[model samples]
Target: MTTARTLAVPAPAPDAAVKYFGAELGFEVDPDDLVRDLEAGRTDGYAVVETRAPEAFARARIPGAINLPYRDLTPESTAHLDKTLVYVCYCESTQCNAATKGALKLAELGFQVKRLSGGITAWIAAGYPTEGDKAPGIRCAC
Candidate 1:
């Protein structure tokens, strides 16, 4: 006689296009790799764009990121030069889609784009300081 047993296993999810740019306009980056690249300062081929507004941005942002605010990338604003610039967009929290939307908008305007893996929240979480807000805030990790 013989005994039979079954084992349970989990499968990895399929790639569902986490980071995307406009129709064939930019290169995309996964969260892990993007963090590595940014930390190494190998971002010469990339530019970080903040999708937040001017008022909100002044309170602090991703240090050197540019202010294009997703809504501003219209036909009028897309006239800027530097088509060869790679872009990464970010917003408030990692859960927010503003960064992704901003990246897509830039791509639609013929600019290369990528979305920040977790937005500004991730940056600050990583201990990278943001330049804004004069008040001192505490970081609490759950």
Candidate 2:
């Protein structure tokens, strides 16, 4: 009687599921939502941050993203950034952890941050336009 969908593993209680998903939303942003906000010019409260190296950023990146490689994240380096803005951090794709690292670093530095779910790969896959020479199909060499 046990099918794969109804195996020993069960779903969380509805309340737990709600809390978990709500918390997840607090820490992540969908590519489509971000693009929609960008198109509507509703980006006043946040900043898109590309966490790749300078070369990778130059290759291709979200149109208005500021490059801030995760490795270089430090208080002094991030001092000029506005503390009031939420930094949406992302890198190549799900294959890269730079976004998570960058988000954590920014948080540690007393900044608000969120990870761009699926990173640049998802953004491009969603048909959003990027800015750079290798846009639209830039693969992660990292």
Candidate 3:
């Protein structure tokens, strides 16, 4: 009589979920990296896309970032954008999912995209500068 063989699957390591997810589909950028990229002029091939409303954008946003609210994304609206350039999407804060939604839409449209991990709140908390009528120049010394 022949015995049937069974395959055994190993269990995931403890506290490896976050890392596994990050590694499987990495698309998050921290505030420091964003700032560093901007300072190095390496952001020429990227676009910091604010995925919030116009009012929110007008109130305050990343320097040189363009407004493209998640709710308003459309084929026509994004038609003029450069597909070759990577798009960095951010919303209000870590609690907000607008940036994720926007990134998904952009990805579906065949555009490379990444989501700002903690969004604008983290950026401001990191002492980064915001641009708007109320906010002037760079808030950071560097």
Encode model 1's per-residue lDDT on 45-81: one tens digit a residue.
7777778776656666766777877767787886874
Q: TM-score for each prediction?
A: 0.67, 0.93, 0.78
Among these predictions, the greatest TM-score belongs to 2
Give the TM-score comparing model 2 with the true structure, all chains together: 0.93
Q: Global CA lDDT of candidate 1, please?
A: 0.66
Model 2 clashing residue pairs (backbone): none
lDDT per model vs. reference: 0.66, 0.91, 0.82
- lDDT, residue 80, candidate 3: 97
Kindly list the per-residue Cα lDDT of model 2 for residues 1-114, writing each as its tens digit.
Answer: 656966668889999999999999999999989999999999999999999888888888999999999999998999999999999999999988999999999999999999
Tell me which residue pairs clash in candidate 3.
none
Candidates 1 and 3 compared by lDDT, better number: 3
Q: Judged by lDDT relative to the true structure, which candidate is superior, 1 or 2?
A: 2
- Best-performing candidate as measured by lDDT: 2
